[model samples]
Target: MPAILLLIVSGFYVGNTVLAEYVEKEAVKVPLEAYLKGHETGKPEYMQKAFHTDGKLMFIRDGNYTTIEFKDYIGRMNGQPAKDEANRKRYIESVDISGNAAVGKIVLDYPNARFVDYMSLLKIDGEWKIVNKTFNVEPKNSSD
Candidate 1:
């Protein structure tokens, strides 16, 4: 009787663990899809959907740390696809989730530069929203 109960309890736990992983991955992908759409369409609305209103973008420029609020970045969108749309690509590399928090990495390739972005997200009000992003950009043809 004791062995049978143990087996049943163990199976339940295993099933729940698998389900949790699947749920987390799918949830994390929601914001990423929105992010990709924003870049592809050059629409600020898509970016607004993917990120929290107060999200911040951080990077280093000329040996100085710089930060841009999401609002400021969205203001620069031109509402048209980039001129190099033919050469543009965005790829989601990986995502790791713990409870309601997650981190994701993606690569963006443009005609003039390549960027790898690491985003931090939180599941808020039943939806995942990007809270922060840090990225490294390499200009095309740069020797470094």
Candidate 2:
């Protein structure tokens, strides 16, 4: 029984190494770039990975800074309904790319929520990950 267990463990290790080596390069970056680009073009599906599964969002308003889970951010965004094509026009005005790191300035222009968002991103072990985010809605009398 011990021998059988040892063999199984060794086999699993070998298989894992082979699979890791066989994967193509730029494979992961494609999905990440696509997701960021989607925000520029307003593809909801692409917005999915912009946050980690257990990601958090931090922002400030009215002299207060608050942090919330990714799901809450998604829920708030989704809760507000918009007309056709309105959803896709939100653009990332600029994406500052530095090797594997990037920062995107996202401008969301909804009827009730017109804000400029800054996303601080990192290449966590080759995966594009959002580390910190800060944004504020354009207030009345403020130039967009």
Candidate 3:
């Protein structure tokens, strides 16, 4: 009975220590949120550090949709003015890891627009990078 109680207590403490709350500290979390902010801040170099060379990006606007090469995406953003990049921000909501694959959900924040998306990650060369994403923007609530 004592042994079982000890194990239960230990598990409870460990779970609390992992996720913030209930007076726990030193709990580690994924760095996806930081990277998202880095990308939004126009630090492509920092953003690139998290992506594989073959990373691909897909976006939709109006009635047209397209997938763009990562290199081209970076190149196009390189010389653009700051205002153009302001609407481009992603907030990573969660990350789940299973072996070499991870699934992440992010919320895109734009002027009068928003989206919740799921991105699949593949670990290549010991680093996790986005491989593909399936997403759709949320329809605006006219009542707001």
Q: Output the TM-score of candidate 1.
A: 0.90
lDDT for each residue of candidate 1 in 44-85, tens digit (9 for 90 to 100):
899999999989999999999999999999889988988778
Clashing pairs in 2: none
Q: Write the per-residue lDDT of candidate 2 for residues 1-144, one digit (tens) a residue.
A: 999999999999999976864442233344446545654544455556666656677778677988988666556444233454454346557666656566777676764557787777776676776666678886544343
Write down the TM-score for model 2: 0.55
The estimated TM-scores of all candidates read 0.90, 0.55, 0.62
Off by over 4 Å in 1: 1-5, 142-144
Q: TM-score: which is higher, 1 or 3?
A: 1
Of 1 and 3, the candidate ranking higher by lDDT: 1
Task: Quote the lDDT for 100 in model 1.
Answer: 90
RMSD of each: 2.1, 11.6, 5.4
- Candidate 2's displacement at residue 8, Å, is 54
Give one clash count per candidate, in the order shown. 0, 0, 0
Each model's lDDT comes to: 0.92, 0.62, 0.62
True-vs-predicted CA distance for residue 33, candidate 2, Å? 7.4
